[model samples]
Structure formats: structure tokens, C-alpha cells
Target: SQITIPILSGDEVNAILILETNQEPRFSLSDWDFARRLAENAGIAISNAQLYAELTRADESKSEFMAFAAHELKNPLTPIKGYAEMMLKGATGELTDQQKQIMHVLRTNAERMQTIINDLRDIARMDARQFRIELSPIDIYNVVIETLRPFMQQLEEKGQTIVNNVPEGLPLIIGDATRLIQVMTNLVSNAYKYSPPGSTITITARPETSYRTPNGNLHKNVMYISVADNGIGMSEEDLQKIFRERYFRSSNRAAQDQPGTGLGMMITQHIIELHNGEIWVESKLGEGSNFQFVIPLAVEEGGDTPETSPDAATEPASD
Candidate 1:
């Protein structure tokens, strides 16, 4: 049956085309022309609707960035700045162990704020196509180590568990080390945030020799890295839209509430793509999630990648 719904949510109206071809052939030609015009009009309406959605999303992203900058970013920075001033002035007598620890937390979080800001600015440049990757031969093993180090102290303090399953003799890939590290950092951070206390988050990487690119081309010696967590996974609907801008926490996350800018994953995509790699996620509602990224093995200088290793049983130890 021909669709009865109006085109583009009634931003334009359309009707079915029926013809009495048994009548004048001239009349049929006129009817067909009108029908063609209606179809063309529908396409225009769809284009306009798509343009509207893009504009709206851009505006919403901008507004969301401002709100986060003012509330989440600025609010934390103020106290951190004030405390540093107090410590420098010696106005607040000798600091106790607890005070020193809290100060350290503040200083660390303030540095994190700077990192988030840098990511945001990088995203803007990326969207403008002005971003470039500094490709090099990278030791992904060391990259994983460096990326996971900053969170070690925090994980210990929170009593949270992390398991790093990346193998010791993994193939190195050619890509931008900084961006890949950023991608891993974002996924690990998100996993840590949504995961319950004492639950474990595992980071794993394996070479994918069987996978093909979207263009149906074969990629040799490609490695796929996954960061998986035993946390509250996303719903099917949420999984479908997880990379969308401005998505916040789920309805069930009261205790796990964190400052979520929602652009983290979006920016992560930009970074990975900039490195000429692909990233995706798999999850179930109650089961855990696995965020994965793929990069070619030849990108690294010293990676004489051998045949794929049969090491599915290895556990992550970087946690």
C-alpha cells in the first residue's frame, strides 16, 4: 500500500497517485506529472527536516557546553583555586593528613578539568576538519599503561577494581598515540563511573584479522581493543543512541551520579576516526558493555605482527 502519512511530519502534504488510464492518455500524463512533482516536493521537505535537525543539534550542543562550563567546570575550579591560595598563604595553619589528601584530590580534579577542556576544544577543531593526527609507531602496551596509571590511585581510594587483559606481547599499531590514549581514557572513565563499587572493569585488546572495513576492503594485521565492564549496561534503545551528543545518566543512577558532559563519546569518535581507526560498543541491559576500537598493526614501527595469538583466556592486569 502507498504510504498515507504526510511527508516530513506535515511540513509538506502529499497524496497518493491513482490513475484512470482507461480514460484519455493526456489526462494520465498530467496526473503522472503532478505525482512526480509531489515526490520531488517530498524530497525537498525531507532535506529541510534534516537540515533543521542538524541545526537544532548544533545549538543544543553549544548550550549544553555552556551549562557544563559554568556549573560543572567553573564550580569545581573555584574551590580548587581558593584552597591552593589558602595553602600558599599559610593562613590555614599546618595541614593535616586528611587536608593534604583532600587538597590532592582537588588538585587532581582541577587537572582533569583542564584535560576535559582540551578535549572539548579539540572536538571543535575536529568538526571543522582542521584537526590532524601526528601518526607514529607507538607501543600500544605502553600507551595502555600510561593511560591507566592516573586512575590507579583513584581506583584504590574508591575501592574499585580494574582488570587489564592487554597482553604483554601485543602487536603495535600505526596511529596517533595521544588520540588512542584519549579514546581509552574516555572509555575507562565511563566504565569506572557507571560501574558499581567493587565491580571490575577489564581492558582487553586482540588483533582482528577477520574483520573488513565499511568499504568492503580487507585490512591486514588489524588489532581490536575492548574496554569491558561488569556494570549497569545500556538499554537497547540507549545503545542505539549512545554516541549521540548530550546523553546523560540513566534513571537508575542516583548514587553513581557523575558530571557527564555527554560529548565525551562523540569526541572520542572524532579522535579515533582522526587516527583512521574504527570504534563501536556492544552491550545488554543487565549484562556488561564492551567498547572496541580497531587499528592496523603496521602503523607501529617495530611491530612485526605475527599470526594472531590465541590468548582469549588472559586476564587484564593493569587495573
Candidate 2:
């Protein structure tokens, strides 16, 4: 005699459970009840496994699409930006005021598109575990200053001012100088975008000798930096989700009005983590916001001094 039980997931049968015996009684009432119960549990587990597989496939597909799309979109932007720059520089001919303004708009939008494409590519690389940074001894103050240079004109137009409180003489930190600049630029840009005209954005930094990680690990000689602004701040709920969620945009009207992909903070967080650092934000609804990060200082082989001079290297802005 043989008995067969079907494993049902929702209304569909996913598999069969069978028992065969040559005895007079192939199965008992209790045996049948146990087999059915076991089959039911197995069905649920199989369904969950299938669902997880589907989700993984979908995530992989999305990342692939983002990478491909970003590459394709980036190709045509090169010529567009080049031509705009040539025209602005009078390569073709002397441009009129109206023509200059038009070219400026073209160049600005092209640069913006390039920034978005780079973000998408970075995100895709991060998903594939291919995103990397070149670390070296870097001055946090110099990085802050270089990052703020391009924003000066925009700040002036908006009647906003920036105060650089990141003093010199602090111990140099081990980091990717370019990536650190990117992180600083993102924070300052957000401050400029969300803050009211005439508001002040402050950049501050200091050395912390007793910084402790959440895991109770004490980090000696870490550089702490913060970008603070009296902008339209975020809610407690938003502060909770900002770094955790990718492409997360706040529900505030000011944030909604800003043109952004909501990927900057997530990318900033990833960059900090790559350097064995931590970043966080403090904010209230009507009050300002403070975005801060801390990275360990670079220690020389024989002593605690930095290997490189802070004034030795300077990163120039691109056109």
C-alpha cells in the first residue's frame, strides 16, 4: 500500500510527499495527520525560498540596468560639454551676452547630468563590490576649502555665506582626499539648497582622542568634522531613515522642491564607511541640521606625526 500527500503553497501544489509499505496497514490515522502537518510547513518554506530568489534576481537586474544606462547617457554629454566650453571661451567666435548666458546654462545642465551619471555608476559599482578609494594622509581643512570653492559664486547669488571653522594644525587623517572632498561637497550643497537666503553654513572640525564606536571600540586620534546650517531641517523620522535607505527623499516641501536623486547622502555614508569611519546627522523640524563624520588619524611609523605636509598637495577644480 502507498499513501501520497501534496505540499500546497497557497492554492497550488508545490511537491508531493509519499510513503510506501508492504505491511497490512500502510499508514495510521496519527501518521497521516503528522505527514499533512509536515507537508504544510514544507510548503510555506518552499514558497518563501522561491520569493527570496525572485527578489535577488530583480535586484541584480536593476543594478545592471543602472550601470548600462549611466554609461550610455554619459557618452553624448562629453561633446555637449566640450562644445559649450568652446563657445563660452570664444573658440568659434565672440559670443553675445545672450549667447554666453545660453551656453552657460547648457554647460551647467550638462555638468549636472554628468554628476548624476557618475552617482549611478558609483552605486552600481558599490553593489558589485567594485567601488574603491585610494587612501593617503590628507588635511581635512584643505579638503573642506577646496570643496567649497566652486560653491562660492552660487552662495553669493543666493545671499548665503559660509564660515570655515576647520582650523589648521590638526593632525592629518588617513583618507582618500578626492572622496573626502566629494563627501564634503555633498553636505555643503545640501545645506545651500535647503537653507534660506542670507543664512550661514558653518564647517567645523576638531581632533577627538576618546571617540568610541557603537560596538564599544575606542578609537584614538580621530578627526571629527561637521557641516552645519540653519536650513529647513528634517524630522526625527527622516533622520532615522536618511543613511539607511537608498534614494530616500524627505517629505518636507523644501526637500521636495530641490532637484536631487536622493543618492548623495547614501553615497557619502558608503564613502565614510570605506575609510573605517562613521557619519551621522542631528536635526529638528524648524531648527538647523548638522552633518558630521569622523575618521582615524594617520600615524607615522616611528611617531604619531603625519607622513605628508598638509600644504604639499592641492586639488584644482575642473571646468
Candidate 3:
């Protein structure tokens, strides 16, 4: 006698298991049941393994393509920017007020394109495990101030108030200055983008008695930095998906008018994790949102290192 069993992957039958035995009863009912269970589990395991391999290959291909495309796009930006600047400066020729304004817009947009290209390059580096952070002792408060400075004009134009509550004499933490500034800038930008005019964005810093690491270890002497906004708060679902997914947009009315690629928070989270820190958010639907992260006050000497390559590649290429 022969026994046949369907092996399923998802809802489809991926294969079949067959058993033929010559015994007194060939196979008992109990034995057949056991065999079915084993075969079903094996089918699921095999399906998962196959899917993983396929996804891995596709991700590698995507990374290579992104790196190539980002590099190609970056090459032409220099001339575009230079020409726009030259025209604005009258290096090409004198221009009327209207022409000057148009040239200014061209230059500004070119700069924004350059920034997007740079971000793409960073994403490629992250996929390739080439994204590096130079760590050193730095004043976190100063970084926050500098990051907020450029946005002052925009905030003022919108009638928004920025209150910097980061106090002086905060313990210097080991961090990648540029990356930390980028994180702060991203958070502050989100606050500015989502909040209505006349709303206040507050930057606060304090000492955390205990900070938890990603690996479930808690460290002492931690510094906490937060950016809070009284803008349209996100739903619980949005908050849960924000950092974990790419190109996630909020359904809030305040955010609907804002233009963003939605990659900022994703990049921000990776940067904090690179510093061996953790990030989180607190929000209510009708209230507001507070975004925060913590880093060790003092890193152990010689322990400065980037995250593992496999870990860095986990995030998709920045869009």
C-alpha cells in the first residue's frame, strides 16, 4: 500500500510526500498521522528557506542597482549647481529682479536634489556596511543648537516658537557629531513640518539614571534627548510602524500638507543604534508626540565600533 500526503507552502501545495512500507499492516493509523505532521512541518521549513534565499538575492541586486544609480545621479549635480550659482552671481550675465529670483529657486532646488542624492549614497553605504561614524567626546547641547539654527527662519516665518531646554554642563557623550546633528535636525524638522503655525517645538535634555541597550543590557550615566511637538499626533498603529517601515506616511492632517520622503526617521533610528543607543516615542491621538533617544554618557575606551554588517543591511535602501 502507498500513502500520499500534500506538502503545503502557504496555501498552495508545493510538493508531496509518499510512503510505501511492506509490513503486517503496511502502516498503522497512528503512524500515518505522525508522518503527515512531520511532512507538513518539513514543507513549511523548506518553503521558508527558499523564500529567504530568494529575498536575499533580490536585496543584493537592489543594493547594487541603487549604488550605481545614486553615483550616476550625483555626477551631474555639480555642473547644475555651479551654473545656477554663476547665473545668480552675474558670472554669466547681469539679471533682472525676476531673473534673479528664478535663479535663486533653481539654485535652491539644485541644493535639495544634491541632498537627496547624498542621502541615497548613505543608504547604499549602509547596505554595503560602509557607513561609518567617527566617535569622540562632544557637547550634545551645542549640536542641538547648531542643528536648530538653520530652521529658525522657517520656524519664525510660520510663527512657531522653538524653546531649547537643553541645559549647559551636560556630560559630554561619545558620539558621531555629524550623525547626532543629523538625528536632531531630522526630529526638529518633523516637529516644524507637522505642527501648525504658532505651535511651540521644545527641545529637552536630561540625565537618565538607566539606559537600555538593544541587547537587553542597561547602562548607567545615560543622557536623554527629546524633541516634542504639539502638532497632530499619530495613531497607535502609525507610531508602531514609523521606524520599522520605509516610506510610511502619517494620515494626520498636519502631515498631509508636508512633503517628505519618510526616510528621515528610518535613517535616524539606524544612527542611534550605531551609537549603541535606543530610540522611542510617546504620543496620543489628540495630544502630541515626543521623540527621544538615549546614549551612554561615557563609552568604554576602545569599544567604539560600527554595528555588524549583517545588521546594517537589514534596512532597505533609503528612497
Candidate 4:
């Protein structure tokens, strides 16, 4: 009254049927064959999922690798482009005021290009985990003052405000000051670029002791700096890719024909990592943004804390 059968084909096989002796059994090869087929289908589905997951991981890794490589190669290229552009316009030779004016434009664009290339290179180097820190003890308050002085005209003409939140008596830190300045420049420039005509950009600096390695050692007290703007913030999707090498442009870039190699954050991130720091962002799509990064506080010396309105219409820094 009972019958049992096993179905076998290729490496994949299905269920074995069992029938009790107490009941009449009406099973044969046909029923067993169908059951085996169903089981094989399930195995195939599982295999597909595994393959898909592998593919996703590979894609992310490849993206990260290329991005890092590209960033590392772009930094030193800036000055090269700048001098070449200058010579082409005969900056060394005397020229009329009109000619000099056009040459100035050429220089400006060249500088912008250099910024983009360098930013890309730095970010890539960081992503690839090959960046080395070149640190020194220096006052950031002086650094900010010097950096903003040149941009004063631009800010004033646009009716923009620059707020400093760094207090006096803050201890100097051992950091690559030039690179640190670059980070602030990128953040500040992005804030200014995205803010409306009459808005403000605030730069803040404060001592932070919260960043600690799992080991008990205090990971050099850190400094938290943020460049914030009340501008046309960004979407979650846009925010997700801000540090990605992939170009994600807001509407302003498209309309103004804003140009960049889209490597600023890639470089900024690398610089931060090289200094043993952290970086992150917070924003609302239409309201504002705060781009924050931290650096080792005592990597050289103190405690300190210090220091936007935008409704719309500017480039929100290229990714």
C-alpha cells in the first residue's frame, strides 16, 4: 500500500515522494518528475539572487576605485593650466587695458579649472586610502581672515554676508594648513555659489573632544568647522552622491553653464581623512545646508568655538 521514489537527473534533483501503506497510493514517475522540476526552479531563483548581489558589490567597488584615481591625478594639473593660459594672452608683454581685461578673464577661468582638477585628484587619493598628512601648527583664525579678504569684493557686490564664529585664544592645530584652507574654500565657495543675491554664509569653528578611537586614547582633540548657507539645499538622492565622483548637477549649473570636473568633495573628503578627521552634511531640499568637517585639535596644540541666507539661484558645488 505504500510507495516511495527518488527522481534524479543532472546535479540538481527534486523531492522524494512517500506514501503510507495504510492508504491507496496513486503516485508514479509522472508525479515525481513534476515535483523535481518545481524544486529545480527554486534553486535557479536562489542562484540568480546570489549572482545579482555579487554584481552590485563589484559595481560599487569599481566606481570607488576610478573616482580615487581620477582625483589624485587632477591636483597638480591646476597650476600648469594657469600659466599656459596666461602666456597665451601675452601677460609678460605690455598690453592695452582692454587686452589686459580679456586676459584677466582667461586667468580666472584657468584658476577655476585648476581648482576642479585638484579637487578631483585629492578626493580620489583619499578614496583609494593612500593619502598622507603633511601637518603643521597654525592659527585657523588668521587663515580664514586671509582667505576671505580676497573674496570681499565679490561678497560685497552681491550683498552677501560672511560671519565668523571662531573665538580668540583657540589653540593652533597640526594640520596641512594649505589643504585645510582648500577644504574651507570649497565649503565656503559652495555656500556662496548656492546662496541668493542678498544672502549670507556663516563659517564656524569649535573644539570637539568627542571623536575617540575604541582604544582609550583620545584621538587628538578635534575641531568642528561648518560652512552653512540658506540656499536651494538639495534632495536626498543628490546628497547621497555629493562625495561620489559621478557628476550630479543642480538646475543652476545647467542654466549657467557652470563648469567643473566634479571632484571637489572627493578631494575634500581625502584631505579630511588624511588629517584623521570626519565630514558630513545636513540639508532640506528647498531650505538650506550645513556642510561640516572635523580635524584633529591637538594634532599640534586648544579649545575653541566660533560663528547664511539663501532663497535660491546658484551652483551648489559639483559632486
Candidate 5:
């Protein structure tokens, strides 16, 4: 005699267990019950394993498509940007006032597109563990000033005021100047996006005795910097999703209408981690938001701090 148990997962029989033995009585009631229970669990495990395998394959395909699409889009943006710049500069011919204004808008958006493409590539490289940063002594205040300079006209248009509270005597920290500038630019731009006209944005910095790294390790002697704005703050839900999802825009109607790729904070977080530092945020729905990050201070030497090595330097920005 034979006893068989059909393993059902969801609405489908995924497998079965069969007991075959030449015995007086083939199986007892208790034996049948135990076999059925074991078969059901086995069916669930098999179904889950198959589902996980499918998901992994899908994720890999998505990554490949993203990398390829970004590369193809980036190649043409450079030439498009160049032509737009030349037209704005009268390289093709002298343009009327109206033509110049149109060309300026075109050029500006082209640059923005290039930035988006670069961000996409950065994200893909980061996933592949190809992203890197060259650590060096950086003057945070100067980087902030320079990064904010380009937005002066926009600030004026919005009637926004910026307060730079970075002290003059702040110590240089070990970090990549360009990436740090990128971080500041993103935070400031985000502030500008959600804040109303005439709002105030502040940048502040201070020295820290010790800081915690992402890996739960503690290190001494770091610098803390923050960008704060009296903008439309995010809810706890939005705050949680910001760093986790790429191209995630806030559910706030105001923020949704604003222009952004949403990869900035994620890239900023990665850069901070590469420097063995931490990044965080604080906000309330009705009040405002503060984005903060910390980087290690340059090692003290007798005369001058040694320059950081260029090995594993940040990958070149996609064209």
C-alpha cells in the first residue's frame, strides 16, 4: 500500500510526498497528519525559493538597463550643451535679445540634464562598488561659498536670504573638495526648492570631539556641518524614504512640482560614508528641515598635513 500527500501552495499543488513500504498497514492516522504537515512546509519553502530567484534576475536586468540607458543619454548631452553654449555666445551668429533669452534657458536645462545623467551613472557605479572619493584636507567654508555663488541670481529672484555661519577659524577636514561642494550644492538646492520666497537658509559648522561611523565604530576629532532652511519640512514617512529610494520626491504637492532628480541625498550619503563619516536629518512637517554631515579632521603633522592618496579616486563624471 502507498500513502501520498499533495503539497499545496496557494491554489496550486507544488509538490508531493509519497511513502512506499511493504507493511501490514500502510500508514496510520497520526503518520498521515505529520506527512501532510511536512509536505505543506516544504511546498512553501520551494515556492519562496523560486520567487526569490526570479526577483534577483529581475533586479540584475534592471541594473543593466539603467547603466546602458544612462551611458547612451550622457553621450549626446555634451554636444547638445556645447551647441547651446555656442549659440548663446554668438558663435553661430549674433542673436537678438529674445533669441538670447531662449538660448539661455535651453543651455541651462541642458546642463541640468547633464547633471542628471551624471547622477544616474554615479548611482549605478555605487551599486557596483566602483564609486570612490579621494580624501584630502578641505576648507569647508570656502567650498560652500563657491558652491553657493552660482545660485545668487536665483536667490535674488526668490527673495531668499542665506546666512553663512561657518566660522573663519574652522579646521580643515579630510574629504574630497569637489564631492563636498556637491553635497552642499544639493542641500542648498533642496532648501531653495521647498522654501517660499524671502525665506532664510543658514549654513553652520563646528568641531566635534568624537563621531560615530556608519559601521558603529567611533572615531575622535571630526567636524560637523549643517544646512538649515525654513522651508516646507517633511513628515516622518518622507524622511525615512529620502535616503533609501532614488528619485523619490516628497508627497508634498509643493515639492512634487519642483525640479530635481532626487539622487542627490543618496549620492551625498555615499560620499560621506566613503570618508568614514555619517549623515543625518531632522525635521517636522510644519516647521523646517536640517541636513547635517560630519567628516574627519585632517591628521595633525608637524609642518603640514600629508596629501591624501589618489588611489581609488572618485570615478570620472559621465560626460
Candidate 6:
């Protein structure tokens, strides 16, 4: 007696399973049914394996392209920014007020382009597992202030206000100060970009206990930081997908019109993760959004908590 079953993936046959037996009884209905089920499972597994391979290839290709494009785009920006700065400083000659304004615009756009390119490069490095952070004991308060300094002019121009409520005396955290600044900058920039004129963006931080790490370990002390803005908020759907998808821009017209590559949040998430931390958002449509993250505090050699002054004044960054 002989029995054969075809393994199918969708409508196509992927393989055949054959059974041969020399006995008084031939293959029973139950045996044939079991064989068919087994073949079906095999076909599904094979299909899934094929699909995963294709996806891996596509991801590698995308990473390569991103790296190449960022490199090429950044190369030309060096001279563009350099010449703009030189002309603005009268290296070429004295400029009229109009010419200086033109140079300022040129320099600003060039800087924006450079920022986008750097983001792309960071994304590529993250994909390639080459992204790194230099850890050190740092004051979160200083990081917040430094991050806000560059945005002061932008805040003034947009009529936006930044309330820096990051208190002093918070326990020092072991983190990359530069990366943390980058994370803060991205959050504050988004707050400014989305909020209406004269709206207030508030930054706050505090100490927390018993925070859990990704590897199931618990840290007894952690620093919690948040950037809250009364800008256009997100829906439940957008909130769910924001960190999961790259290049995800909101469907809101106001959001769509804003200039962004949709990579800031992604990079911010990665930086937090590198510090063994987590980031999250809370928002309501037409209201505003608050972005938050927590990083574990550093412990001293003798298990004593080394502390700083938590008495930093709560004030606006524009101050």
C-alpha cells in the first residue's frame, strides 16, 4: 500500500510526502489525515523561513543605502555652512543687512540639513549594531540646561516658553551626557515644533525607586525626566505605533506640515535603551503630549548613595 500527500503553501504545492507499507492492512483514513496535517505544517514552516530571509535581505539593503546617502549629503554641507558663516562674518566683505539675513537663512537651513544627515547616520549605525555611548557620572540638571540653551532663540522666535523644572540634588546617573542631551534636544524641539505660539513647554524630573530593568533586574533608585507640551496630541492608534514604526509621521495636518524625518523618537528610544532605561508618551488629541524616560542612578563603592543638591530653581529655559 502507498499513500502520498502534497505540502501546500497557499495554493501552491511546496513538497510531497510519501508513505509506503507492506502489510495486511493498507494506510488507514486516520493515517492519511495525520500525514496531510503534518505536510501542511511543514509547508507553513518553509514559507515562514523564506519570508524571513527576504525581509533580512531587504533590511540590510536599506541600511546600506541610508549610510551611503547620509555620507554623500553631509560632504557638501561642510562647505555650504562654512561659506555662509564666513560671509556672515565679513570674510568676503562687509554685507548689507539684507545680505546678512540671507546668509543667516542659508546657514540655518544648512544646519538643519546637517542634523538630518546625522540622524540618518545614527540610524544606520543602530541598524548595524555599531551605536555606542560613553558612560559617566553626570548631573541631569546640567544636561537639561545645556540642551535648552540652543533652543532659546527658537523659543523666542516662536513665542514659546520652556519651564525647566528639573530640580537639583537628584542622584547622579551613570549615562552618556552627550547622548542624553541629544535625547532632550529632540524632545524639546518636537515640543516647540508642534505647540502653538505662546504655548508653554515644561520639563520636570524627580527621583524614583524600585524601577525594573530590561533583564528582570531592579534598580533601587532611578531618575525620571519628562518633557510636556500643550501641542497637538496623538490618538490611541498613533501612540501605539509611534515607537514601533520608523518614519511614522502623524496624519494631522499640523503635524504633516512640520519638518521632521520621523527618526528623532526612534533615536531617542535607542539612547534610552542603551542606558538600560525606558521611554514612553502620554497624549490626548488636540491637547498636548508629554514624553518621559527613566534612567537608573549610579551607586557608590560602599553602597552609599552619592547625592547632589536637589535645590535647582524651577525656571524657564529662556531665562
On lDDT, the leading prediction is 6
Taking the tens digit of each residue's C-alpha lDDT, what string does model 2 give over 144-239? 878988898899999998988876657889999999999999999999999999999999998887687544567678888899999999998898
Question: For model 6, how does the per-residue alpha-carbon lDDT over 1-319 read when each residue is reduced to its tens digit?
Answer: 8889888878988889999999978889999999988998999998998899999999989999999999999999999999999999899999999999999999999988988998999999999898999998888988998898988888999899888887667788889999999999999989998999999999998888776544355656888889999999998988988888899898788899988889999999999999988888989999999998889787787886755544556533334
For each candidate, what TM-score against the reference? 0.65, 0.89, 0.73, 0.60, 0.79, 0.82
Write the residue-wise lDDT of candidate 1 on 45-148 in tens digits: 77777789999799668756754564566666777767765774566888888877777667767766766666666655555556678876566776788789
For all candidates in order, the CA lDDT equals 0.70, 0.88, 0.81, 0.66, 0.82, 0.89
Global fold similarity of model 5 (TM-score): 0.79
Q: Which 10 residues in a row give candidate 6 its minimum summed lDDT?
A: 309-318
By summed lDDT, which 10 consecutive residues of candidate 5 come out lowest?
310-319
Among the numbered candidates, top TM-score falls to: 2
Tens digits of lDDT, candidate 5, 1-319: 6779888778898877898779777678888888888998999998899899999888777767778888999888889889988997789999999998888898889878877887888887887777888877776666777778888888988999998887554677888898888888889989988899999999998877777744476767878889999999999999899998888889888789987798988998888888888888889886789998888888667744433323223422111
Higher TM-score: candidate 2 or 6? Answer: 2
Deviating ranges (above 4 Å) for candidate 5 = 1-27, 126-130, 167-169, 211-219, 284-287, 301-319
User: Ten residues in a row with the worst lDDT in model 3?
Assistant: 305-314
lDDT, candidate 2, equals: 0.88
Model 1: CA > 4 A from native: 1-94, 212-219, 246-256, 299-319
Stronger candidate by lDDT (4 vs 6): 6
- List runs of model 3 lying over 4 Å from the truth: 1-48, 82-95, 211-219, 299-319
Cα error, candidate 2, residue 238 (Å) = 2.1
Which of 1 and 6 is ahead in TM-score? 6
